[model samples]
Target: MDLEKPQADRQRDPEVREPEGCLVVAIRLPVRIIALVVVLPVRMLWDALVVVGRIVRDTVLRPFGRALAWLGKALFVWPLVALWRWVLVPVGRALGWLVKWLVVVPAVWLYRHVLTPAGHATAWVARGIRAALTWIYERLLTPVGHGFRWLTRYLVVVPVVWVYRWVLAPAGRAVAWTVYWTGRVLFVLPVLAVWRWILVPTGRVLAVVGREVWTALGHAWRVTGHLSLAVGRFLGTLFRWVFVEPVRWVYRTVLTPVGHAVRDAVLRPVTEAGRAVGRATRRALTSVRESVRQARYDVRRMLFGEPRERVAMARREPAGGETRTLEKRVRREVSPPTRG
Candidate 1:
C-alpha cells in the first residue's frame, strides 16, 4: 500500500527467480506428457530387448555348448574311457583267470587227481582199518570188555551170594530161633502157665462151685457156659470194657480236640507272624538292592573314569618292579596227614 510496486510480472511467470547471488534455481513443470510419449515406451522396449537378448543368447549357446561337449567327449573322453575299459576289463578278467589258475584250478586238479586217488586209497585203507578194528575188537577189546563185565558181575554177584550165605543164612537161623522163642514166650509158655496154674484149678474150682450153684440155681446153670470158658469170657469182657474202651474214648474225645484247638489258635498266629516278617524282610531286601544299585553307580563314576589314561600310565610303568619286603621261611614235617 505504500511504496512497493506490485509484483504482477513475477506472479504471471512460471519459473521462480533464485535468491540473490544464488547460483542454482529450481523450477516445477508438467513433464507428464514427455514421460508418457518418450521415456516409458523406450524403457519398456529396452527391458524387452535385454530379455530377448538373454533368451537368444541362452538359446543359441545351449546347443553349441552341448555339441562342443559332445565333440570333446567323442574326441578325448570316450576313447580314453573305452581304452580304460578295454584295458581294465581284460586285466581284471586275466587277473581273475590267473587267480583261478593259481588257486582254484590247481585245487580242483589236485582234488581230481591227487585227492581223488588219495581218497580211494583212503577208502581201501579204511576198509583194511575196519577189518583190523574188527579183529582187535574180537581179539583184545572184546575179551577185555568181557573180562571187565565178568569181574563186575563177579564183584557184585559173588558178594551178594556171600552175603546171602554168610550173613542172611545165619541171620535167618537166628531169626527163626528168636521167633520160636518169642512164640513160646508169648503164647505157648503163657498158655502152659495158665493151664497149669490158673485154668485147671480154676476149671476144677468152677466145676465144684457150678455144681453147688447148679444145685442151688439149677435153671441158671443151663443158661451159663462151661466153667472155664465162662470164667475167661467174663474176665476178657471186663478188661476190654473197663480199660481199653475208656482209654480209646478219652483219647478220641478230649486229646484230639484239644490238640487241634491249640494248633489252630497258637501255631496259626505264629505262622502268620512268620509270613509277615518274611514279607517285611523281602521289602527291606528290595530297598537294600535299590540302595546298592545307586551306590554302585556312584562308586563306578568315582573310581572307573579315565580308563584310557590309567591304561596309558600303566603301559609306561614297569611290571613287578617293587622290592620284596619279607624274608623267606620254610617248615618241614615228617608225618603223613590224617584225614577224616
Candidate 2:
C-alpha cells in the first residue's frame, strides 16, 4: 500500500516524465551530448579551480595578507605614533610652557604693574589741569570779560544804535521808497503787462492745438490697430488654406498609408531577415568556439595525459523528510498582537 501510494503520487506529479518523439529526441540528443561531452568537464574543472582558489586563499594568501598588514603597521604606523606620543607631544608642551613664561607672562606683568599705573597717573594729571583751567575761566576771566563787554557796549554799540535810529534809518527808508517807484515805472509794469496779455493768449492757443493733435493721434492709432488686426487675420486664414491644410492632408492621407505599406512590406521583412541571420551567425559562432575549445582540450590531453577526476562536493540542501517543496511559498506570516 505504501509503495502504491508513492506510485500514485508520482502519477499525480506535474513533473513526471513522458517519452520523447523522434524529432524531439533528435534535437535534444545533440544538446545533451554536447552538455555531457563539453560542458560537464569544463564545469567540473571550474569547480575544481574554485575549490583550489578557496584553499589557497584560506591556507596561504589570507595569512600572508594578515602578516603583511601587521608588518606595515609596525614599520609605518607604530613609529609615527611613538614619535607623536613620546617625542613630539612632550616637546610641544615644553615649547608652549617656555613661550608662556618668556613672552606672555612678561607682557601681562608689564601691562598690569607698570603700564596700568602710568596710565592712571597721566589721567589724574589731565583731570587736575582741566579743573584748574575751569576754575580760572569761571572766577577771573569771566568777570573781566563781562566788564569789558559792558564798556564796549556803552562806548561803541550805544552810539552806533543812536546814529542808525535817529539819522540813518529815515534816510534808508527814503532811498528804498525812491528805488521802488523808479523800478515800478522802468521795469516791473511793462513786464507784468507783457506776461498777462501776450504769454497767456499764446499759451492758450498752443494748448488747444496740442489737445486736438493728441486726440487725432489717438484716433489714428486705433484705426491702424484695427486694420493691422484685420490684415493679420486674413493673412493667417490664407496661409492655413494655402500651405498648412494641404501639407496636413498630404501627411495624414498620403504619407501615412505609404509609411504603413513600406513598414509592413519592406522594413519589417528586412529587419526579420537581419534577426534570423544574426541568430544563425550566433549559433555558428557557438559551434565554432566549442569546436576550437574541444580541439585545444584534445591537444592538451595528448600532451599532458589525462588528469584524475575530482569528486564533486556534497550539496547543503535537505534531501530528507520533504523539508521544502517548489510548490510552497517561502514567505512566513506574522502572529497578531495579544489583547494584553
Candidate 3:
C-alpha cells in the first residue's frame, strides 16, 4: 500500500505541480487555429506566385534569354573565335617564331657560350675566398668562440640558475597560489554559481516555451495544408461542372453533326469540282509545254544548222555486207599457196 501511494503521488506531481504542461495545453488549440488562419492565405499566395514565376520563366524569359545568347554568340563570340583561329593564331605563331630566333636563341647562346665561362670563373674565386674563410674560422675563431662560451656559462648561466632555483621560484609559487584563491573566490565561484543556479533554470523555462511554440506552428502548417487541398478540390470540381461540361456537351451534341453535314453536302461537291478543274488545267499545261518545246526546237534548228550526227568508226565492212540477199551477189577470191 505504501509503494502504491508513492507511485500515485509521483504521477500526480507531474500533472499538478508542473503548471507549464497545463499552460501549454490551454494555449495550444487557439494558437494553432490562429496560425492556420494566418498561414493559409499566405501559403496560397506563395503557391500562386510560384506558378506565375514558372510560367513567365518558361514562356518569356527562357526564349528571350536564348535569343540574347544566340545574338551574343553570333555578333561577338563567333567573330572573336574566327579571328583567333584564322588571323590571330597565325600572327601569334609568327611572333613566337621571331622571338625564338631573335631573343630566345641569342639568350641561350649567350648563356651557354659567355655566361657559363664567366660563372665558372666567378665560382672559382668564390671557392678560394671560402676556403680562406673556413681556415680562419677553424683555426682562430673556433678557440675564441669556445672561450666566450665557457665564461658565459660560469658568470651568467650559473648565477641565473642559482637565483631561479633559490629565490625566484619560491616567490613565484607563492604569488601563483595567492592568485588562484583570489580568482576562484572573486570570479570563478560566483560565475559558476550564477550559471548553475540562475541562468540554467531560466534557460530551461524559455526552452520549454520555445519548443511548445514551434510544435504549435508545425501542427498549424499541416492542418492548413489539408484545408487548402480540400478547398482546391472543391474549386476544381465546381469549375468542371460549370464550364467544361457545357462546352463538351454543346460540341458533342450540336457542332459535331453540323460539321459533318456541312462536310458531306457542301464541301465534297466543291472539292470534286476543284479537283476536276485542276486536272483539266494540268492537261492544258502539258499541251502548251509540248508546243513551246517544239517551237524552241524549230528556232534552234533555224538559228544553227542541223546538228551533225555522230558517225561510228569500224574496223571491218558493215555487218550487212556479210548477209547476202537475193538482190546482192557474193564475191570469191583466190590466194597463192605458201612456199615450203
Clashes of 3: 0
Give the per-residue lDDT digits (tens) of candidate 2, residues 159-261. Answer: 9999999999999999999999999999999999999999998887666556445544444444444555565578779999999999999999999999999
Task: TM-score for candidate 1, please give it.
Answer: 0.22
In candidate 3, where is summed lDDT lowest over 10 consecutive residues?
A: 326-335
Number of backbone-clashing residue pairs for each candidate, in the order shown: 0, 0, 0
lDDT of each candidate versus the true structure: 0.71, 0.79, 0.85
Candidate 2 TM-score to native: 0.51
lDDT of 3 at 164: 100
Q: Ranking by TM-score, best first?
A: 3, 2, 1
Q: Model 3 TM-score? A: 0.65
Model 3 pairs whose backbones collide: none
TM-scores of the models, in the order given = 0.22, 0.51, 0.65
The prediction achieving the highest lDDT against the true structure is 3
lDDT of 1 at 54: 89
lDDT of 1 by residue, 1-340 (tens): 0112248966877875543221111111112222233444444455557767889879987888999999999999999999889998899999999999899999998899899999999899999999999998899998889889999888898899989998999999999999999999899988898899998987876665444443333322322324434555677799999999999999999998998998999989999999999999999999999999989888987898734444444453336865433331122144456798
lDDT, model 3, position 8 = 67
| Candidate 3 C-alpha lDDT tens digits along 1-340 | 0111266686767555344466666666666667777888876666668778999999999999999999999999999999999999999999999999999999999999999999999999999999999999999999999999999999999999999999999999999999999999999999999999999999987776777677667776776677777877788899999999999999999999999999999999999999999999999999999999999999999999799998978844438548644444332323455699
